[model samples]
Target: MMDIIDLKKKAAEIRIRLFQMIHNAKAGHTGGSLSNTDILTVLYYHTMRHNPQEPKWVERDRFIASKGHSVESLWCILADLGYFPKSELETFSQFGTRLIGHPNNKVPGIEMNTGALGHGLPISVGMALAGKRDHKDYRVFCLMGDGEQAEGSIWEAAMSASHYKLDNLVGIIDRNSLQISGNTENVMGLDPLDKKWEAFGWHVVSIDGNDIVSLMETFNSIPYTEGKPTLIIANTVKGKGVSFAENAIGWHHRVPSDEELALAIKELTEQIESLVSKEGQPHE
Candidate 1:
């Protein structure tokens, strides 16, 4: 296992890089991307079994970004992991670039081309079922947005995953409670989120999405029960690290201006320093 300090450092670095990338592109989903950063961080930097050198390595665990507009954070993490060059991110949202605003199979580490809501979980269920049939030990993880739960297809997939008894599949919902329009409850009530998944026959775990320790502990406890898929509802702030954008609906698709970017950098930089100061502290 990698040291918690080192993992945190890598996550902070990815956050900084994504912030810069979005600011430069002036066109990327900011809120969900930021909300889900720590989730991506822990998975890519710590938990996942992936080889950047061989993205197609069949033995590797598969990751699918269901809420794919938040691809900026994933792209940054993948680049840092050496799946692709860091410089490739400079082409994000450019006229001719594979690194578009959503997850694309053209990208080496991306398992599927996903921007359409509610598709990732179903595909991941299939992946898990395939692994089961082939006697592979690899797990399939899919991350979805809570607001996306309003989509009927998502529930359908949930039912399918449970019916298959996909113990190898894990679902994570970025329950930031804010979507592109407004508060998720106001838009489409999904309260008692855990019960909803539980009724679908999944083992559910709720945790603070931004807390690295919480994320690590929760992920380590996966397959919470036998013959069931796991679903983690990660409660989080929409624009997590940025003070000005946190929980604000407009930030969902807004780009940070020069001044706002500087402020966000300052805030995140302070967080980086704080984490460094806790380097020697015992991690849970």
Candidate 2:
């Protein structure tokens, strides 16, 4: 396990990489990606058991980024984990690039091709059921957008997961208040989100999505129930780290101007520096 400080440093780096990739691509989903950075960092760098070299290793834990628009964060983390060269991150959303706007399974570390809203949970349920049937000990983690809860398929999948008693599965909702067009509540009310999942038989946990400590603690609490899946409703801001973008619906699919991108990068760099300095000593 990495020390908490080291993990935090990695999280900051992942955030910087996410901003750079999205800014460079000029056509990626920066808002959702930034909002989920800490969660993905915790999962890829610390919590989940995965083999970057053998992405399809059957015994490896599965992570499905259900809110596929958040692909930038996952792509950066995978590159940092050595699933692919970090240099390849430059091709994100470019013509002929495997790193499309949403995740594609062809990407070295991506487990599923997602981007279509509300598809990830059901697919993850299938994966979890397979693990149960085969008696595999591997766990499955699925990350969904808060707005995605509006989809009826998500509840359907939730019911199926409970019915199958998939204790090995974990669902994480990035409860960032804003979606593309407007606030999620105005677009489609999903208040009482936690209770809905709890009613569906999932063990629910809510946490501050951007706090690394809270994220680690929340993830560590998975598998809390013996016969049920766990659902973590992580309350978050839409564009998490960048001041200009945070919680602003305009950034949802908006391409940042050159000036905005430079500013965003600068802010992320400062965040990385702060975390690195607080680590007491540099990584060897």
Candidate 3:
């Protein structure tokens, strides 16, 4: 059984580590990384079944981060889970570090090398299809950004997933709305996003991406429908934790200064403390 409260605390800590990773490295997609933190947290800490000690376990679930630039959070989660030594994080974005700015397959726990915007979903579809053909029980999950929706290849992959009735594939979109250039709608409108997925034959579920409780419940109801791929539209705020960066466009690829890092650290620390105070308490 997964402890919901611990999951919440883990997410907060991951956010702090994620910020530290970028601050030390002096480069990262800050806004997107923070926006998708909760989703990544829930998936790694609660939903997915895998052995960090045996990352290549044959029956383990596969995860692909399609929106690869915001990989700082994922790296933090993997290290915290013991996929690699925590010390490796200090080498992030340095000369010849496996912990680059995007998801890299060379790093253990990552199923594929992504970040090209539209490639993750298609590759995941193929993985799910292979699992079905092999009679394996593993599921494939892909995390993508809202801005990546502009890629036509995503839809084609969606169509293919549904055509194959890939119920084993689940995808979550961090609908933070802001891209590097600006708001997603302004850069490329993707409103009516749910309808578009439904039309493509996916089982769609919309949820508050930041809420651990809600995300856990949603994942429990996966394969929303039989014979369909599930698509979760996780509405999120860009730069989720730090006040100055939340929903701020400039934070997309901006490194935080020392002062900003102090502020972020303080915010994330408080979040963890707050959760600790509520530990073992009943929620109404």
lDDT of 3: 0.92
Which pairs of residues have clashing backbones in candidate 1? none
Instruction: Sort every candidate by TM-score, greatest first.
Output: 3, 1, 2
- What does candidate 3's lDDT look like per residue over 1-284, in tens digits? 45888887888898899888899999888888999999988898888889999999989999999999999999999999999999999999999899998899999998888878999999999999999999999999999999999999999999999999999999999999998888889999998999999999999999999988999999988878999999999999999988999988999999999999999999989988998899769952
| Total clashing pairs in model 2 | 0
Q: By the lDDT metric, which is better: model 1 or model 2?
A: 1
Q: All predictions: root-mean-square deviation over Cα?
A: 1.1, 2.2, 0.9
lDDT by residue (tens digit), candidate 2, 1-284: 77677777777678777777877887888888888988888888778988988888988999999999878888888888889898999999889988888888887878889988899999999999999999899999999998888888999999999999999999999999888778889999987888999999999998998888888887887799999999998998888888999988988877788898788878878877887777766543
User: What digit string (tens of lDDT, one per residue) describes model 1 on residues 1-284?
Assistant: 56778777776677778889999998999988989999999998778888999999999999999999999999998988898899999999998899999998998999999999999998999999999999999999999998899988899999999998999999999999998788899999998889999999999999999988899989888889999999999999888888888889999999889998888889888878988899878875
Compare the candidates by lDDT and give the number of the best one: 3
List per-prediction Cα lDDT, in the order shown.
0.90, 0.87, 0.92
Candidate 3 residue pairs that clash: none
> What TM value does model 2 have?
0.95
User: How many residue pairs of model 1 clash at the backbone?
Assistant: 0
Stretches off by above 4 angstroms in model 2 are: 281-284
